[model samples]
Target: MSLLLQIETATTSCSVALAKDGVVLGFKQINQRNIHAEVITLFVEELLVSAGLKYDELDAIAVSSGPGSYTGLRIGISTAKGLCFALDKPLIAIETLEAMVYGIINADQSAISADTLLCPMIDARRMEVFTAVFSAGGTKIKPTAAEIIDANSFADLLEINKILFFGDGAEKCREVLGAHRNASFLPDFVNSAVHLTQKALEKFRNKEFEDVAYFEPYYLKDFIAGKKAV
Candidate 1:
């Protein structure tokens, strides 16, 4: 029986889950903005207590490594690393976009056909998002990229494929891509720690652990500090 702790703060959601043998045991999450730093550790503690498992009992600690928020990823990775170091446990890093796709498929597998594609997006800013494309079977078709939404975006693929666009970034994109017959949007599909269960379990079975001391979240872009108002 593999016991794991999962953390996901990749977007505005601060979520934590305890899973044993790929089954979610307990979960706690809040989707308000700017609460990651405040609630992540508390949520972890609560879940551990609720699940009746000690930190050292965990087989591995899984975190959603991001192509999403810079600060959110930092908080989640730092917390996971801290726990891993303290308990001498291996660390598992789940790709943020892949996890989001898993959450979607897990929720409604019937809606996705073999030819349908999954495009998970994370809001970067106005009209821009971090996204990637995956097949219904979870094979990555397009690598993660920062894309500027426009009427012409994904035009070629939409012509040939039925693409399901989701995540926080998908809402803004609906208007821009709505006219395309093959472009479909799944609104309100936020990233969650529950989604990390299966992927983390696979990594644990394959012994795909990261170096606890050096592992960092995949911040696809460099942080740019905002200028002070004069």
Candidate 2:
């Protein structure tokens, strides 16, 4: 009977979902840059109204703890934290890439072979991405890290395994990894809050909650601020 409010602002998607017992009741989202700060709260309120739940009724708030955009993560985590504090509900965090793995697998797309591997990438800068590798069953076979994609990237794995490269960062890799018969790319893939349900539910059941007072997003790489305009 857990009611969870999920938010994902990682990458360019600003999404919100309200779920009951791990099932998405209602959700809304937009894939646009620099709009998270404007629409995240609106999305949450709309979901609450559509789902017939109030802030106080949420059992917990789940947010994507990211290896994604620094600003996007900040907006998402701050919004989730604000609700948790106002409602006195617990906060749960799911890794951005992990939820993404859940997203693609849950899509039930055409047969993913037993030998196929799952990898979700979040755009960083030119040629670099925040990424990880997962088994077909969604187990993390490789740790999350910031990788610079090149012809040799994942060479060993690509030799024997079919790897699916996806997310906002994957499109850029096609030129580098395309010739490999073992590597394939998923186009137009965007992260969504809906994917946070299963893991959030598991964390709620296990009482795995973050300290509301001191939680922070997993920025993966150090954020370097741009130079000030002269």
Name the weakest run of 10 consecutive residues (lDDT summed) in model 2: 106-115
User: Where is model 1 more than 4 Å wrong at Cα?
Assistant: 228-230
State the number of backbone clashes in model 2: 0
Tens digit per residue, CA lDDT, model 2, 53-136: 778888999999998999999999999899888889999999999999999888875668888999999999999999999999
> What is the C-alpha local distance difference test score of each model?
0.93, 0.93
Runs of candidate 2 exceeding 4 Å displacement:
228-230
My TM-score estimates for the predictions, one after another, are: 0.98, 0.97
Error of 2 at 208 (Å): 0.8
Model 1: worst 10 consecutive residues (lDDT sum): 48-57
Clashing pairs in 1: none
